[model samples]
Target: MNRLFDKSIVLACCIAAAVGLAVDARLVAAFCLGVIATSLAEVAQGNRARRASETASYVYIIAAVFVPPFVPLAPLAFYDIARRVRREHAWVALGIGSVFAFALIADLRTDALTARTLLLTAILSVAATLLSLRTAQLEREQQRMRRTRDELQERALALEARNRDLADRQDYEVELATLAERARIAREIHDNVGHQLTRASLQTEALRVVHANEPRIAADFADVKRTVDEALQLVRASVHALNDNAVDLSVQLDCIVEGARSDGGPQVELEALAEHAPANVANCFAAVLREALSNAMRHAHAKTITVRCMEHPSFYQLIVTDDGADATPASSSNVAEGMGLASMRERVEALGGTFTAGPRVGAGGWRVFATVPKPQGDEDR
Candidate 1:
């Protein structure tokens, strides 16, 4: 809209300069040529077309000197030159000088160098050039402002996203601290109160034996022992639940490998734990891994062991392998079912899973593998 308004001002000035002038065939031809040059300059979009339009406009301006009827179109050439030069003040001055030179040549050729003619031609051309130059400068300033506004908007959005991430991290740290406190309380109850209760129950048992001849006293002591035993069982269950809820699969696996390494045993490595498993699955896998490590170190005299726990979309899998050579199943179809292995197999099968324990196919090591399928609602997990 601004560009159209600017061009309209130049056109109005051109018309004012041509007032009181007579219309003829030359004037109509000049107007048609001016429209053609403006169309090529404004509508076409290439360097070659712009150069062609500029060249044609200059030629038309020079030729119009002979035809006074072409006076209204001459200022359009100067306006276009100002627009092309944009902010180059020196080039705009040079263009105005060329206009005076063209007028002097006109005076040499014909007696058309009247003061009135020179004023209308030179003053109107200057007005059009000034208007075009100022309009170009305003357009460039507007474009720069738009680019700066867009960059600021992008930076604000990035800062907002960073703030959200920081808030989420703070919340996560608080949750971890709460879980750790619960686990610490559970451990304290198990270690301190649980042991005291066991000792009390044992003392009551010895008192019962000592008071066997007194029926009433033996019966009272027996009730006390039963109560103490019940309390101990409850404490153990509470500790187990607290520990299970507090520890995720990654931490449990880490503890398993690290505990084995710290026990003056062989080198143990926890290779991978891809995703978190459910509580029951995690507890089962931890148990299986502990049993496997014990068998490897004690029975097989393994020098190294590796463990992995992976959670798939439909199931959870645990793998334990050790560089042990004391696997004895050659005559029994590789079916050495001991109490530990049987316990591990039963735990897995109870959860609708499969278990395998034997020597590796092409290695001198025992491998224990278990996989438990997810429940119906958790299959997509």
Candidate 2:
């Protein structure tokens, strides 16, 4: 659009100069030079060049003063000034253009000063000013539309980023809820199902003892007890899985031991002796073993930890010893009890067991020993 307007302006100027040359060659030469200079100034680079271009508009006004035929060309300079310069400057250019039009009227020959010539020049000047103002308004509107579009695009991108963040948060929240539900189920199984299984196993063992004299019935009772024990093991495994813990006690203990080793703690020696032990004893042993190893690594700073599971004639025992300075033997009265030690004691004593944890008598480390009594007359044979 701008290119077409420029071409039209150049063409009109050439035609006007040609008409002026037909009337007077000397005056047309000056008008053509002024037109060329103004055109070059319009395309010149920088603020100074643009101001110089605006100043060049006066050359057209000067030419109009000498030749009445050049009066029409005054509007072209006014239009350029209005389009390129500030409104205040454009108003000044209009004033100058109006003055040049009157000057052309004053310079006109007596025969040329007709109402038709004066009316035509007035109409053309008004049209040029109005056209320039409309073009400026349109340019401002286009710029505003471009700004609005950019703002909308930026807002859309921001909204997309926020939505992605919200989705990620929702996924994390769902995963957390799932894990919490699994933990709740595991706790329920441990408290209710686990207790019932332990009780059933004890009752079956009691029945086998009562019917010992009757060989056939005693064997059947023994098989029932073994089945109950297997069920207890299965329940324990289910609970561990639900809680996302190691399924087997031995495996769990080995993992803890390896973790300690990897952390540059103690060289742990573990022995799982009581393979066919009841579920309750095995679970208790696992808890105690974990606490012992934790104490050995954290408190004792032990170089070596020996973990053993011993099954006696009528009991299940676990011994965990660590070779560290804090494990040096102290009297019961002198030993300072911590929550870990206290919790282990409470858990063991709850099941008719003896729980002792302190420095070993001869060894330069700590020792944790727990002995849980089995049902009377019951043995893992």
Candidate 3:
């Protein structure tokens, strides 16, 4: 807009000068044609229009040679040539030389060779050329500023991403420190308080045994022994609770998957590991996953194994499947039971859950699935 406004002002001044020269009707029509052609040449963008504009520019120069009114509009031609000087030096020289030739021809033919007319042409041409050069310089400055702004914005985005990473790392460290502290506390209680309680129970049992011949004293010692036994149980339960609370299931499962990956045997992917699972359930699922992977590696010679665990409202479920071609089910539809399968079954059954390991129906793979009901205590928690 600013550039166009500058050009508009120069064109208006040229028109005002033409009016002062008392241009007749023919001169007015000639003036309009030259103005239209030169303006189109100045603003033309595409190649086709630019070619047509160049032709019009030539026509405008030719018209100026015959029409005296067009003498003032010579500045537009000079401005266009000046703007292209850096890109087309030879064309600019030719264009400028043509303008001088046309101006000289118009003056000689019209017999109006005045000092004022020459002075006016010189001043307007210089002014229009300066405007073009100034506009080009401004555009270069704006481009530089845009590049700097874009670079600064990129740096700012990178810094923000780094800050987010640092924040996440800090949060993980704090969580690790908290878990470590809890483990330390649980260990201290087990070693100190639990040990002391066990010793008390043993000592009381000895007293009860020693006083068995005396009815009254034996009864009293037996009661004390029972009391000490109950205290010991409470201490053990408290220690277990502390340890369970410290367990991070996600971290434990991640480590298990990472260790399995290091072996470079069958590819292992943890399909899922459910959240909000009790510590015992998490441990059981992880153990089942490890056992299944081991069996697949040794006997099944599986290509891939997938481990999935989920905690439902009523039960926790685990599924470990493997694509082991060598270890398909027998004709009777029974896969041979192994010690590892037995252990997993026992673990789940002990927790009031069901466990199954078999050749996947309608598939060329083995599937080990287990589902344990949510413990009463865990449900309450």
Worst 10-residue lDDT window for candidate 1 reads 328-337
Per-prediction TM-score to the true structure, in the order listed: 0.58, 0.52, 0.55
Question: What lDDT tens digits, residue by residue, belong to model 2 across residues 1-381?
Answer: 652375366446435433523457644664676567557655879988877776776666676676666665566666666677675555676577667766755745454444555555566656765776777788889999998987786566445434543553465456557767988999999999999989999998899899999999999989998998999999999988777621355665677667667665568898976655544565567667766776677657788889988778888888998888764232123247655676577768978999998778865778899999986656645
Give one digit per residue, the lDDT tens place, for model 3 in 7-107.
78778867655554655786677667756766786688997887687666555655666666666776676566555555645675567556676676558
Model 1: residues with Cα > 4 Å off, grouped in runs: 46-53, 65-68, 86-101, 104-117, 209-214, 244-381
**Which model scores highest in TM-score?**
1
Q: Backbone clashes in each candidate structure, one number apiece?
A: 0, 1, 0
Superposition error at 110 for model 2 (Å): 6.8
lDDT values for all models: 0.74, 0.69, 0.70
lDDT of candidate 1 over 1-381, digit per residue (tens)? 665676677667766666665666876787788767766767756888877877776776767665666666677777776677534456644865576567655764675544555566677777877877888889889999998887676565445434543553365456557668878999899889999999999999999999999999999999999999999999999988777552378887788777788666788888765456665677678778877887788677888888888878888899998888857412222245665676678779978999998888888889999999987877775
- The true-versus-predicted C-alpha distance at residue 297 of model 3, in Å, is 48
For candidate 2, give the lDDT of residue 246: 19
Indicate whether candidate 1 or candidate 3 has the larger TM-score: 1
TM-score of 3: 0.55
- Clash count in backbone of candidate 3: 0
